[model samples]
Target: MATLKQVARWVPSHWGAGHLVLAGFLALLVLAVSPVIKLDLVVNGLFLGAIIGLGAIGLSLVYGILKFAHIGHGDFMTLGAYFALFLLSDLFPRIGLTGAGLGPFTFGYPLLLALPLAMLAMAVVAIALDLGIYRRLRRRGVNPVVLAMASLGVAIALRGVVQIFWGGGTEQYPRVSKLFYRLPMDVRIPPDNLFVGGLTVVLVVALYLFLTRSKMGKAMRATSDNPDLARVSGINTEHILWWTWAIGGALAATAGVLLAVSQAQLVPIMGWRLLIPLFAAVILGGIGNPFGALVGGLIIGVTSEISTQWLNPSYKPAMAFLVMIIMLLFRPRGLFGAKD
Candidate 1:
């Protein structure tokens, strides 16, 4: 009982309960119409939303810690996916892992080997970006808006660089066929989606644990809340900043890889296009609240997917912007933002 209380205090009560109820209601609705609607839509939406949630969490971290909008975040995601693509195409083949050699692996299986490599590469890139641009600006005492503009420029440059290397054409994941889980009444769920969704949940839970239970994680929280105080309290602000970028970059890369795996396509502009919606999720949840970011991400993902049923799919991204605008107008602190 004592343990449960401690856990409950760490995790938000109303939000968790509310989301569970909402998810339950959604499941019921899907079951009620299971006879009519294809199970693929529900499964696909859930899976895709999970991937979106991953990227959204990274964006939230950047916003929460750095206190600036990172418009280029999606590009970083795209870079991670492209990095994975390069690894698979160039490196994987040379190591006697060619053709059906890779067939033994399924998206359902944990990417034990590839995941860390991808995360490391993305973290390096993120730190490089900070060293090259953001750090310089901070040293010069540049305003946050200037920093935001610089990030936008960096985003565009990164996108162009990706296009130059990978070509402007869409690249597809090789050999991995979509496996479906068959159910009654012709309903099928993609195993890849299930894998991605499950991985996302695990990542989020792990992040929550790290943030609340670990020493460095608490230092990160302290830094985000009050940098001066954290610094004065003997916390190494520089170390925290490095970890923040590293974690954010790694998560962004993970999201990119999962998204590409689920969709089986990688394009340079794909991540850039996702930027707005990702930011919307971050802002909607609360600028600096990781838990809020998770809920906000889930909300954005589900809402975007469901909106396709009622409106044209082309306008789906607009939904994010609309939500952001409304939130800004009504609740500037966001749905679960702290009352600072």
Candidate 2:
């Protein structure tokens, strides 16, 4: 028989017996249902999970590198979607790109192209933001709390700018008529969802590879782990900071574009409302842990969607807060976070 300490060491840090038990319970609950729940809801939940995961990744990167919670991060996502909106509006007519717009391709095709462009645009914007606001503050040696406040101000100001350009009305991407997959119960899956999900997986895997395999990625990890040590080791702190902002901004934009295509709508508050769940995902996954953030996003997305079956649809947003509070009370360091 193994001693408790030995058994503890054998288990994965984030996947102890308790987590296994919870997983088993959830599985049993799903199996016990007489008639299956709505397939649409499950599929939608998965799609939502992917979008939230993308946004959460960005938040995790920023938290890890910048050592502050960026309340304004979601705005970057909104900015990306708006960028796509403008591009689509301009390109569609000229290129005669109609109904998914990739020349006999599905809805996913246009989005596939749009997402990268949006990400690049957002990355540029992030660099600019750093240069304009954060760099100045860093030079002044401002405290992290003050920097957090500055992020909030940036959020509000960006919202104002978006409103001025796009106005307060809701707009949508052109709807694609083709369905990628159809289910047994008359449920339809759009190409956009497939595209979004595929893109999310690719990005997540790529990010993981970059973090683990690339030199810059290692430098970023070093900085996140300990800025003082990184500086002492001659790591270019400024370059790493710029990369963090750029990567975070790009991820946020990608999330925004994905959400827009999935919902087919662009609203100023889209990203703002999403911030709650994004934060919840980040915290639940473990602060400064990208993998944790990914899992957290999925959990939040599924729970929120499932809860809608029991609670009012309007209460879905509150479910994230409830989960966050519970996690904070029980596992303050989050599921994957390192314990002090």
**Alpha-carbon deviation at 102 in model 1, angstroms:** 7.1
Q: Considering every candidate listed, which one attains the maximal TM-score? A: 2
The models' CA-based lDDT, in order, is: 0.77, 0.82
Q: Which 10 residues in a row give candidate 2 its minimum summed lDDT? A: 99-108
- Residue-level lDDT of model 1, residues 48-69, one tens digit each, is 6677778888788788888888
Query: What does the lDDT read for residue 59 in candidate 2?
Result: 93
TM-score of each: 0.86, 0.88
Task: Count the clashes in each prediction.
Answer: 0, 0
Residue 36, candidate 1: alpha-carbon lDDT: 50
Residue 114, model 2: Cα distance from true site in angstroms: 2.5
Model 2, span 39-62: residue lDDT tens: 566667778988998999989988
Any runs in candidate 1 off by more than 4 Å, and if so which? 1-42, 99-112, 184-187
Query: With candidate 1 superimposed using the best TM-score fit, by how many Å does residue 176's alpha carbon deviate from the native?
Result: 3.1
